[model samples]
Target: MNNILRAKNLGKVYRVGKIDIHAVRGVNLDVEKGEFVSIVGPSGCGKSTLLHLMGGMAKPTTGKVFIEGTDLSMISDGERAKIRRDKIGFVFQRFNLFSALNSQQNLEIAMQICHNGNIDHQRIKEIMKLVGLENKLQHKPLELSMGEQQRVAIARALVNNPLLILADEPTGNLDSANSYKVLYLLKDLNRNLGQTIVLITHNQEASKIADRKIEMKDGMIISLS
Candidate 1:
């Protein structure tokens, strides 16, 4: 498989007064097309920071990130924003759904924003069904359970046919049963849709479903297998 993303000596540092906090340090990794890779670590390990850098949401303090062979650090902010909008999809722990809109409408808005008004109703329906939200299309986020809202978020992420899906603590807010449901859905997307997924989670069971796992500690990748 071809590499969809490549990171070379990637690092991030935050300054607080005179002290520098290293968030990520000298990480080199590659994610191939259509692979499910998970980064597992404790809090403050910079898992989310790595995902943000890969998605072009945050610039690395040192080193390079290449998405589809284009150097992300070399691109202008506007170009990077466009790259994120066109090539990457993000799912977060909060579910980030518009509470006022029904599930279908919420997905529609995502489609419009990603596709710029060329919404494909058929594709939207297919993705909704893939995430097991076909029957709950008209329900608002407030009316849905935590699991359902996350499913809607997953559907919205898939609506754009993104090259890579970045999920940050995707099941952190769910009960055990719902967590299993969401993980199963993510596995199915990898198996069936052939979507490239990069997930960051603290759950070991969740990390097991991934094809490859990287464990991080103190801003460094301690293990990769």
Candidate 2:
């Protein structure tokens, strides 16, 4: 299979006052097409930083990242933004839904972002139904439970039919039951739809669902299995 995502010599450094902290250190990885990969570690181990770099949300201090053969570090900011909007869907730890908008409207906004204001209501309904949110389309974020809110967020991510989904602690805020629901939804997307996914999490259950598990510690990948 071709590589959907690749990072070579990836690194990130943060400067705080007089102190320089290395967040990632010369890490290298490749995610094959249709593969579901997990990055797991304790806090401050650079899992999130690595995810950001791979997703083109943050530039690496050194080396390169390529998404579907496009070198992210070589692209202009506008081009990178376009790639993110059209090719990548992100599910953040926070639901990040607009509290004022209903579930359908929230997904419509994402469609608009992806399609440059040509909202596709039919596609929105399709993705909502896929995520089991068709019944709650009119519910606002405040009206839904945490699990429902996360489902909406996942639906928003899927509305664009992105080639890659980057999830950062997607179930971090949910209880065990809700977390399992979210994880199973992701697994279903991979197993059934063949969606490429790179997930960052501290939850062992979340990581166990992945096809491969990579353990990171102190800014380096310690083991990959």
Maximum-TM-score candidate:
2
- Candidate 2 clashing pairs? none
Q: In model 2, what lDDT does residue 197 have?
A: 92
Q: After superposition, how far is residue 38 of candidate 2 from its true place, in Å?
A: 0.5
- Residue pairs in collision within model 1: none
Query: lDDT values of the candidates?
Result: 0.92, 0.92
Candidate 1, 1-225: lDDT as tens digits: 389999999999999999999999999999999999999999989999998988999999999999999999998999998888788888999999999999999889888877778778888888888888888999999999999999999998888889999999999999999999998899989998799999999888899999999999988999999
Q: Which stretches of candidate 2 lie over 4 Å from their true place?
A: none
Tens-place lDDT per residue, model 2, 1-225, is: 388898999999999999989999989999998999999999999999999998889999999999988999999999999989998999999989999999999998888888879988888888989989888999999999999999999999888999999999999999999999999999999999999999999877689999999999999999999
Q: What's each prediction's TM-score?
A: 0.96, 0.98
